[model samples]
Target: MKPFSKLREECGVFGAALRSGEAAGLTYNALLALQHRGQEGAGIAVAREGAVFCRKEVGLVSEVFDGRALESLGRAGLAIGHVRYSTTGQNICENTQPMVIEYLRGRIATAHNGNIVNALELKRKLTEHGCVFVGTGDTEVIATLIAYEALRAAAPSPDPGTAPADPAPSALSAPAAPDSAVEAAVVRAAKQLVGAFSLVVLTPDKVIALRDGTGFRPLCLGRSAEGYAVASESCALDSAGFTFVRDIRPGEMVVITPEGVTSRQVLPAARQGFCVFEYVYFARTDSVLDGQSVYQARYEMGRMLAAEHPANAEVVCGVPDSGLEAAAGYAAESGLPLVSGFVKNRYIGRSFIFPSQAQREAAVRLKLNPLSFNVAGKRVVLVDDSIVRGTTSRKIIASIRAAGAKEVHMRISSPPFRHACHFGTDIDDEKALIANNMTIEEVARHIGADSLGYISPAGLKTACVHGSLPLCMGCFTGEYPLFVGRHTKTQLETR
Candidate 1:
């Protein structure tokens, strides 16, 4: 089988509950709002009285969960949900998220939002200890590790037959001995795990939210009339009618229960390396990440790209959704006409599901049909967020040429991806990256574009003015913030 082309984003996790009742409906709503983050699969898990009920499938949230499944998942005061886009693992039903594990003590259902760099090593060690895995996914590996560590913490007294103290119905009280014990167990487990992760776990007693020490991914807290919610992106909270409270601090764990929300610091705050792509392409335009609006960031990128690479063209067009904002900025700066050259099919859910390569190519055409009238005999400048493998750019150029464009100049908003990213953005294997092997001019000629240019790394830094903290240009510059070995097929498959 051919290696799959990697995209730039990963998954989204949402967990919420109303102290009054299970948040099945609200979680469903939140997942719907976060569906933009992942379209391949979705799942929801609800915990009630030490037992967990879950429903998941390989499809969009609407396709997977209906009235029947929602009712079946039923009401537990605690529920966690996930939408997944496969990064390292195969896209299968078993890999769909919110993995639930039933242990000797209680049940834990977890949904994770980022990739673990040392997942394969951890999996190997766990398997040697007779840990059986049902799914070939990194999220499952995390769930197993957390469970293993929790069990280890509970050892020396195998059967501590004490029930966790129940909180008062109306007042917030100190966490019971069991709650504190489990919290310590999870903290110890998290310390052992490395790489990028923003996780939400539904335990029998509370919902725990945790972010990695470096804050590689974004996670925020929100509040609804029913209760508090935690999600990967703030836009989901907005769509679900929740007020944005604040972002979950890096390395912080906040446990929400009937007694109210309590936070504990598992690790001290450090310089955050949130994925810059979140602002460029991944997040919804309306979403604000790290005190900046995604739309504004892209707009600034476009303006900066225009200043760096001033192109003379009759019309400027972006490659569908992600590129649209930058294209608008380019047109505004270059004094060129901005036209909708391509019309995207909003109904297309997942781009990877097309039956064959030919079908996938055709799907691209069907997904974004070009406006012949807008490009005929005109010089067109195409703007896109980034070029991953050059396949998409080649096909897009073909579309523009087929539409009778005389000249096609390609402009990229972000610098070329020359290194693999271990912090959530799904860039895998430097050998597969076109920029790593070929220069910009070579890639332009290979893709049949007249000219191609990328925004300089300096411009990327200048786009953010308020802070002098350095951004992770690892994918562009091959300088990683964390040490990550070159990823191999063996490692990805086994993990």
Candidate 2:
């Protein structure tokens, strides 16, 4: 296996409703709060008196859903939204979600927050059976699978007693009844899926939220005076003025209607394996996942790293964004002066769009400018969340050196990534991972740092304070929690 490299983000899903009025605005607000989870695409799906209307585009939520688009989406009692980061395929306009599928029974709009590992295999099977795909996203594969199962479940049986509820002739073109038949069909379809996923589906009459058995991603439920809401993070719900109800249990499926919410178990309960990286890198500091504060967890990680690898340096600085909290913790623990060594340009979006290596390097300069006063003639301890390809780290280190730092030591908060992640995380092939190609000493030299250290796997687990559950540390240990095929070679060749 090649070394694990930084992968793109999966996506974020948000759904909401107000009992008294339209939910499009609330859903928009929720999407904005969850925007950190993805930046490539955004969309909203609304249902008004059984009619589903949607507006989606390839851009940030603020750019995609303007007044005109919102007006076209119209008012609705229920709405579901999505912010996307491509994991399975290239990011494109057609791949923006929440994907709306109008089936024979009713219209269903779905937004998903994780990758389905077996999606390619399932998509092939479905395609051979005459299923047509509109986009190259895994969410579409899931939607098509559900539609197929629902249609099969709707088939008339030789024994009338076992037949699914037949739609009334007058209601043939309307939404199907939200009865056991439809729920059973959903459960059956869910069973066929493999990998991490937290999904919210909007039907003509109800909203359904489901999490994979292992619960690798976070999904929470909330309530407002209007109705119920489901979001990828509690922060989004809080921003949208909803009270946190609870997290969707692992392997649990929930259906919410005007009457009440119903729960069903599609898989047996097992040990929870929520991703520890959510606290370290993925989730926003203001959010909580699996009952743990993301900010606190990251702070603890920095504290632990300092205890393990205290550096004698004049100033301690962190990489922008993800590493800031950890740097603070390191500074506090090491009693080193915390200084802002680099000023990051808040305007730059994702790094993938920088057309060339020189442009990408220039982007780094534009995104972060070294503060001469902070590092001139001083020994610097640089704290970063992780080092994937070592490209960004190399640039930052060179910049710090150029700013007159006497010596620079790099400290990483997470264990070295040695294997690829098959879950929804964007870790690509292992060959691109610095840890795979170079030892710690080599990596230090490659990045032009005086010294380097990484948090041990044990340290990471300790930081999360998750004792009862096992973590999927595949990226660090090369031991996958589940069966992921031998595609690493193929992935590497393509890369």
Model 1 Cα lDDT, one tens digit per residue, 234-300: 8988876779998887889988775568887776556567677777788888887767777877888
Q: Model 2, 182-256: lDDT tens per residue?
A: 565566667778778898888776778899888888988888777888889999999989899888888899887
For candidate 1, the 10 contiguous residues with the lowest summed lDDT are: 167-176
Q: Whose TM-score is greatest here?
A: 2
Name the TM-score of candidate 1. 0.90
Off by over 4 Å in 1: 1-6, 152-177, 351-360, 466-470, 487-492
Give the whole-model CA lDDT for all candidates, comma-separated.
0.78, 0.78
Name model 2 segments beyond 4 Å from true: 1-7, 154-180, 350-359, 466-469, 487-495
CA RMSD per model (angstroms): 5.7, 4.2
Candidate 2 — what's its lDDT?
0.78
lDDT value, residue 206 of candidate 1: 77
